[model samples]
Each structure stands twice: as structure tokens, then as C-alpha cells.
Target chain A: AQKVTQAQTEISVVEKEDVTLDCVYETRDTTYYLFWYKQPPSGELVFLIRRNSFDEQNEISGRYSWNFQKSTSSFNFTITASQVVDSAVYFCALTPPIYNQGGKLIFGQGTELSVKP
Target chain B: EPEVTQTPSHQVTQMGQEVILRCVPISNHLYFYWYRQILGQKVEFLVSFYNNEISEKSEIFDDQFSVERPDGSNFTLKIRSTKLEDSAMYFCASSVTGIYNEQFFGPGTRLTVL
Candidate 1:
């Protein structure tokens, strides 16, 4: 079974504060994919990032960063100086091996972040 | 930038009535998919379509659910009998290639079952 777990149901932070959202996954396949999506209040799924099993290098884009550690089975996301606009639900997802046509995205319960000004 | 688009931003229907949600995937993309998210719930995959056929489907995509690419550009998802549980935000996504590529999602259609 392939599963993504986001343990934090909700988190609150003041504007310009740094916050980290944790994601843990379970998968049997040696080759798989991990993803993070942001859903704003408008109710749209916005793509954040995607990482493969072989890539353990951390990634940073502007104020957002992702740390992928296969040993820990975790792909965590960090937002530096989060603003009120960052208030949204963040989801972690896992994709099956290459054979399943990019397979269905198995998603975590998602973490709702509320950044206040 | 090419983005996926969906029609009927909001739809309200009776529990027993049928409803069809429409989507237009990005041009040049070959794979299409459907997903849904209930209020305050996580997103769940419904089905994946390729070559005008279903490549995969989740357990939640039961017999009541069906997908079709009626024309060259439009893809549709039809619910035979809308149930209260079926009320959710239906999202359409497409990817140029199934593997090693990201799937782009649309604004989504909010289905409200009364």
C-alpha cells in the first residue's frame, strides 16, 4: 500500500513567521513520486513541488523549501517568512511506480495553515 | 501558459438526478484525470483516462461513475445518480506524459447536492 501522512491537522502563525509542515509516506515500490499542493480559500489545488525517490537533495524556491529524506520516509516543506496569503491547506501526495500511467495520487489528510497579519 | 479549464463553476442538483461535469484539458496533453475533495476533506483520485479509455480508477469510482471524451477537446464525467456524498469539488487534471511530468489542474467545479 502507498500512503502519505500529514499529522498536523492545523497550525497558526503570525505574518513573517517561519513554519514547517511535515509529511511521512509509506510505499513498497523502489521508484515512486512525492508531491505537495496548496489549496487556497478559493478552493483550488495549486501545485507546489514534486520529488522522486532517487532525489534526496533539498529544493528551495523563493520563500518555500522542500527537504526530501528517503531514510526517514519523509518529504517536509518549510515556508520562510510566511505571509497571510499563505493561509491555505497543504497536501502531501504519493504516486505509484511508472507502470500505472503516473498512477493515482494518494494524498494525505492535509495540513491547514492559517497565517495571520 | 496553457491551463486546464472546467465549466459550471457551481452546480446544484437533486439527490437522485444525474449531473455531468465538463473539463477542457491543456492541448498537447495526452493523459487526463478526475479527482474530488469533500468539504474539509483530503483530495481523492477518481479515475485516469488515456487513449480514449480508462487506464486506472480508484475504489471510490464505482459503477455509478463514468467518464468520456465526447469530442476532440472536451472531457466529461457523468454521475448516474447524484448522492449527498457526491457533493464535492471536482477537479480535472492533465499531463503531457504520465510519468516524470506534473499534472496541471483546473479551477474545479463545485457540485452541491440538495
Candidate 2:
């Protein structure tokens, strides 16, 4: 079984503040991929980043960063100096290579982040 | 970059009616998929299609739901009988391959069963 859990349903932060969204995953497969997507008020999903299991390097892109830890089975995302436009529903996903064309993705419940200016 | 496209940003249909949602994937992509997200709920996978056939489906994808490519440029999802619970935002996605690739999604169609 492959599962991703996002315990925080909603979070609010003032503009320019930093926020970290937590993601915990459970999978029996040794090889897998992790992803983060953003869904704005428009209802369109935007792909943000993808990380493979072999890579545990913490990545930083612009004001966004991700931390992948195998020990904790966690992939956490951090937004530095978030702006109002950064407010969106963020989802954590896992893709295990064995099932369904090997392209199926298991998504978490998602965390709704609201940045107030 | 080319992105997947969907038709009718919003659709309103009565319960028990049949509805078809359409999608046009990126021209060079080979794998296609459909996913649905209900109000305040997590996005759920429905089905994946490749080689003009269904490669995989979730438990939610019942016999009432059918998918067809119809032509080289268009893919469609047909629901035999729409229920109130069928109301959701349906997203179409496509990937270059069906293995270990990122699947790009469309703007999605909001189906409202009244």
C-alpha cells in the first residue's frame, strides 16, 4: 500500500512569513517518487516539483524548498517569504512504480494555505 | 510548454442524466488519465488510458463510467447516469509515457448535478 498523509487541513500566515507544510508517506516499495502540486482558486492543478526516493538532498527553488527524509518517511515543503499570490491548496503525492501502468499517483488530503497581505 | 486542455469549464446537469467531459492532451503525450475532486475532498484517480485501452482504474471507476479516445486529438469520459455525488471537478492529464513520468493536468471541468 502507498499512502500520503497531510495532517494540516488549513494554515494561515501573514504575507512575507515563512510556512512549512508537512507530508508523511507509507509505502512498501523501495523505489518511489514524491511530488508537490499547487491548486489555486481557479481550480487548476499546477505541478511544482518531483523527487525520487534515491535523492534525499534538500532542494531550494526561489522561495520554495523541500526536505526529503527516508528515516521519517517525510517530504516537507517550506515557502520562504510567501506572498499573497502564493496562497493555494498544496498537495503531497507519492508514485510507487509497481501499480497501474506505473504512473498512478497517490495524493494526500492537501493543505489549504492562506497568505494575508 | 504544451498543456492538456479540457472543454466546458463548467457543466450543469440534472441527476440521472448522462454527461460527457472532453479533453485534448499535449500533442506528443502517449498516456492519458482522468481524476475527480469533490467539494472539499482530496483528488481521486478515476482511470488511465493508453493504446486506446484502459490501462488501470480505481474502485470509484464503476461500469457507469466509460472513456474513449474517439480520435487522435480528443479523449472523452462518459458517465452513464449522473448522480448528485457525481458532481465534481474532473481533470484530464497526460504523460509522455506511462512509467515514472510526470503527468500534466488540465484546467478541469466542474460538473454540477442538480
Candidate 3:
């Protein structure tokens, strides 16, 4: 069974504030992939990042950063100096490799972020 | 930056009607997938296609759901006799390869079953 949990249902912060969205996953496969997506009012999912299981490197891309910790099975995403345009529902997803599954992605419930200007 | 494209951005159908959602994946991509999300819910995988066949499918993809790559450039999901429960936003995604390549998503088609 592969599952992703985003404990934060919703988060509210003023513009320029930093926000961290927590994500924890459970999977039996040794090899897998994790991802983060942003869905705005338009209802389209915008891919943010993808991290493989073997690489636990913390990555930063401008205002977005991701921390992948294998020991804790947690992949957290943080937005620095968030703007009102950042308001959206963020989703964490998991996908196993071909060796394990058909590479179908399973998603978390999502965290609705409200960045008020 | 290459991106996937979906057609019929919105569709409305009565219950028991058949509907086909189409997608044009990234030209170089080899893997294709379909996923849907009910309003206020998580995105759920329906099926995956590769090599002109289905690679895997979830429980949600029953006999009522089918996928096809009718042409070299188009991938489509056909829902036979759609139910009211089938109303949702369907998304199409594609990846370059199985391992390291990341999947890119399209805008999605909003299916409204009445």
C-alpha cells in the first residue's frame, strides 16, 4: 500500500510570510518518487518538483524549496516570501517505479494555502 | 519547455452518455496517464498507457473506462455510460521515460454529468 499524508488541511499567511507544507508518505517499495503540485482556482495541477527516493538532497528553486528525509519518510515543501498569487491548494503525491507498480501517482488530500496581501 | 494539451476543456452530458476526453501528450514522451479529481478531493489515477497498450489501471478504471492512442499524436479516455459520480476534472500526463523523467500535466477537462 502506498499512501501520502499532508496533515495540514489549510494554512493562512500574509504576503511575504514563509509557509511550510508538511508531507509524510508510506510505501513498501524501496524505489519510488515523490512530487508536489499547485492547483489554483482554474483547477489545473501545476507540477512543482519531483524527488527520487535515493536522493535526499534538499533543493531550492528561488522562492520554493523542498526537504526530503528518507529516515522519517517525509517530504516537506516551503515557500519563502510568499505572495498573494501563491494562494492555492498544494498536493503531495507518490509514485512507485515500474519494478513495483505501473508508476501511477497517488496523491494526498492537499493543503489549501491562503496568502493574503 | 514542452507541455501537454487537452481538448474540450469542458463537457456536459446526461447520465448514461458516453464521453471521450482527448489529450495530446508531449511529442517525445513515451508514457501516458489519466487521472481525475472529484471536487474538493484528491487526484486519483485512472490508468496508464505505454507502447500502444495499457500498462496499469486502478480500481476506478472499470469496464466503463477505456483508453486509446488512436493516432501517433493523440491519447484519449472513453467513459462508456458515464454516471453522475463520473463528473469531475480529468487530467492527462506524460513522461519521457519510466525512471527519472518527471510527468507533465495538462489543464484538464471538466466533465459535468447531469
Candidate 4:
């Protein structure tokens, strides 16, 4: 079984500040995919990034970056110079390599981020 | 940009009534899924379908839940009976292949059971 945990239930940050959301996963499989999704107030899931187990390199997309560390079983997402629009509930999900057989994602409880001006 | 779409943004129904949630996955995508999130809870997976059959499902996807790709473009989830506990935001998603692919999501259908 695969499980994902996001310990931070809620976070508040001022505009232009940086924030990092922590995610930890447990999976016995050697290969898997990690995902970060954002659900805004309108309740739509937005795909952020997907990182596979073999790719431990940190990724940066504009102001968004992700750190994948296999040793700690953690995939952390960071937002630099965040704006108010970034306020939303962020979720971390895990999918095993043999997805067709057991592809259902194990999702974290999600972290609600509130960005104040 | 291509996206998965779901219909009937909100549906209200009485207990024991049957309801079907609809989705149109992105063209060329091969795998589809249904998930639910109760108020103030983590999203829960219900079922995944591919090649016109269920590939995987969770315990919550019991006998009452069924998924069908009735035509080439539409994927539907039917609930045999509605329960108060069944009220939640039902999301439909699709992926190009399998585990390695990103699952694109629809805006979701908010089902309200009365």
C-alpha cells in the first residue's frame, strides 16, 4: 500500500514571501510517480508537477519549484514571491509504477494556504 | 489547452434514487478515473477504467458503484442508490497511459443527496 502525508494542515504567508509545503510518502515499490495538485476556492484540481522516483533532481517552473529526495521519501514544493492567487489547498499524491494494476493515487490530507496582502 | 470535462456541475437527488455522473476525457487519452472528496476531507479514489473495463478500485467502490465508457468519448459513473453519506464532490480524471502519466482532472460534479 502507498500512503502520502502532508503534515501542514494550514499555512498563511504575506504577499511576496516564500512558502514550502512538505510531503512524505511510503511505498514499497522501487518506481513510482509523485504529483502536486492545487484546488482553488472554486474547487477545481490543477495539476502542478509530476516527478518519478528515478528523477531526484529538483525542478523549478517559474516561481514554483519541487525538491524530490528519495532518501527521506519526501517531495517538497516551494513557491517564491507568492501572490494572493496562490492561496489554495495543495495536495500531494503518489502512484505506483504498476499503475494499471494498482494505479489509484494515495493523496495527502492537503494543506490550505492563505496568502494575505 | 485540452482538458477533461464533467457535466451537471451540481445535482440534487432524493435517497435511493439512481444518478449518473458524466465525463468527457481529453481526446487520445486512454485511461479514466473517478474520485470523491467529502467536505473537509482528503480526496478518495473510487475506480479506474481502461480498455472499457475497471482496472482498479477502492473499497469505497462497492457493488453500488459502476463505471462505463458507453461510447468512444464519454465515461460515466452510475450510483445504484443515493445515500446521505454519498454526497460529495465527484471528480473525473484521465491519463494518457498509466502510472507514469499525469492525470488531468475535470472541474468536478458536486452531488447533493437529500
Clashes of each: 0, 0, 0, 0
Among the numbered candidates, top lDDT falls to 1
lDDT of 1 at A103: 61
For model 3 the local lDDT of residue B21 reads: 98
Tens digits of per-residue lDDT, candidate 1, A1-113, equal 89999999999999999999999999889999999999999988899998989989999999999999999999999999999999999999999987887567889999999
**Candidate 1 local lDDT, B51-104, one digit each (tens):** 999999999999999999999999999999999999999999998887678888
- Give per-residue CA lDDT, model 3, range B40-109, as digits (tens): 9999999988899899899999999999999999999999999999999999999888446677899999
In candidate 3, the residue pairs with backbone N, CA or C atoms under 3 Å apart (3 or more residues apart, or in different chains) clash, namely: none
Which portions of model 3 show Cα errors greater than 4 Å? Answer: A98-101
lDDT of model 4, residue A16? 100
Please identify model 4 stretches exceeding 4 Å from their true place: A99-102
* Higher-ranked by lDDT: 1 or 2: 1
Model 4 chain A worst lDDT window (10 residues): A96-105
DockQ-superior candidate, 2 or 3: 2
Which residue pairs does candidate 2 place in steric collision?
A: none
DockQ of each candidate, alpha-carbon based? 0.73, 0.68, 0.64, 0.73
lDDT of 4 by residue, A21-111 (tens): 9999999989888999999999999999999889999999999999999999999999999999999999999997663454677799999
Instruction: Write the number of the candidate with greater DockQ, choosing between 1 and 3.
Output: 1
Candidate 1 local lDDT, residue B67? 99
Candidate with better lDDT, 1 vs 4: 1
Better by lDDT, candidate 3 or 1: 1
Candidate 2 vs 4: which has more DockQ: 4
